[model samples]
Target: MSKHGFFQITQKLFLRDGDKFLVMRDRKSGLGDLPGGRMDEDEFFEDWYLSIKREIREELGANIEIEVNPKPFLIHKHRVNEGNHPCVIIGYHAKLIKGKIEMSDEHDFMEWVDVKKYDPTPLFTEYMLDAVRVYLKEYA
Candidate 1:
C-alpha cells in the first residue's frame, strides 16, 4: 500500500433522537461507530457539513433529512489502514428531521445508545468512547 498523502478527513455524524445518539456496527470491524464516511473533495461546499449530509443520505437512505449543527463538536486524528495513511476525524452533531433509517449494507447493525449510561466497550475505538463522553458532557 502506498502511504504518501495528506490526512484524509472523515466526518462522523452524532445523530441525536431525544436522549440517545445513533451508532452503527462496522461490517469490517464489528465495532460501533458514528454514522459517517470520508469527506469528498468539494469546491463549492468545502465544509464537512455537506459531505456528512451526503453520507447520511447514502448510508441511511435518500428519504432522510438531517439538520447538521454548524460547527463540529469534536476533532480526532488517527492513522488509517494500520498506519498506511493519516486521517483526521471530525465529529458533528445532527438532528434527524424526517424519514426512518434504511440501513445500508456497509454496516451490520445499528443502535441508539444513551452514552451517559451505556457501556462503550463495544465501540471500535477509544476515540468513539471519548466522543461519547464529550457529547454527554456538552449536550446531556
Candidate 2:
C-alpha cells in the first residue's frame, strides 16, 4: 500500500485455445476477472508487470505476456467509504501468451470460459464487468 497517487495495474488477458478466448475464474467467488495486483511505492509499471506475471504464473500457472496497450477499457473510480484509506482499481487488456492454468491458494480454482456466454456473478463489481464486456466485443 503505497501513498503514491497510483498503486495498481490491471490487464485483460485473452487466452486462445484453437479458436477461443480463455477467460479465467476465481476459485471461491467463481467470477471471471483480469490477472492483476497492486504496485508498491518502490515499484513501477514494468516491475508491477513482472510481479503480477509471477503471481499469475504461481496462481494459475498460465503463460502470460504483458500486451503493450495503454488504453484501459475501464478506469473505474469507486470508494466504499469516504476515508483516508484509499482503495481503487484500474483495469486494462493484456492477452495471454502460453501455459496451462494451475490454481493457487489465492483462488479456489479457475475457468476458461467462452466469451459469447460470459456472465459476471455477484462476486464481481459492476466496474469489472464493464471491462469484460469491452474485451468480449473486441475479441468476439
Candidate 3:
C-alpha cells in the first residue's frame, strides 16, 4: 500500500442468508455496498462489534436480529472520492437471525442477491466478491 493519502477506515457488513447476500445501493455513488459506515471518533477500537451492531440497528432498524462474526472476515484496499483517494474497508460477515429487512434513508435500494446467480461485476468490487466467495465456501 502506498502512503499517498489519508486513510478512511470503514466497516462493512456482508449479511448472508443461504446463498443470498444483502446489499444496499449507495445514495451518493449509486453503487451497491454493505450497510455500514465509519466509526465515530470517540468510539474505541475494542468496541468494533458493538459499533457495527449499532450501525446495523440504525441503518436496518431495530426489528432485525443479526449475528455478526466477532472478528472481521476480510479487508480490502480501494480508492474512493474518485480514483486515488485511499480507503481501507474492513468487512464483516453476518447472518440474519430474525425479521425481514427495512431500509433507512441512507440507502436508496436494498436487495438480496444469490452469489452464484448474481452478476457482481460493475456492481461490486473484485475484493468484495472474492471475500464473499471465500465466506460462502466456509459457511454456505
* Tens digits of per-residue lDDT for model 3, 1-140: 66656676678888888778887777777766788776676665567777787789889999999988878867877555345456777888888889977788878988888866666666666555565556556655
Candidate 3 Cα outliers beyond 4 Å, as residue runs: 1-5, 81-85, 125-140
Listed in order, each prediction's TM-score against the native is: 0.82, 0.59, 0.80
Candidate numbers sorted by TM-score from highest down: 1, 3, 2
Write one digit per residue (lDDT tens) for candidate 1, span 8-127. 777888898877878888777666767888777662367556677778877999888788887887897755534446778788888888888998988889988775777666665666
Candidate 1 scores a C-alpha RMSD against the true structure in Å of 3.7
Per-residue lDDT value at 102 in model 3 = 79
* Model 2: lDDT of residue 93: 53
| Weakest lDDT window of 10 consecutive positions for candidate 2 | 78-87
What's model 2's TM-score? 0.59
* Per-model root-mean-square deviation over C-alphas: 3.7, 5.4, 3.2
lDDT of 1 at 26: 71
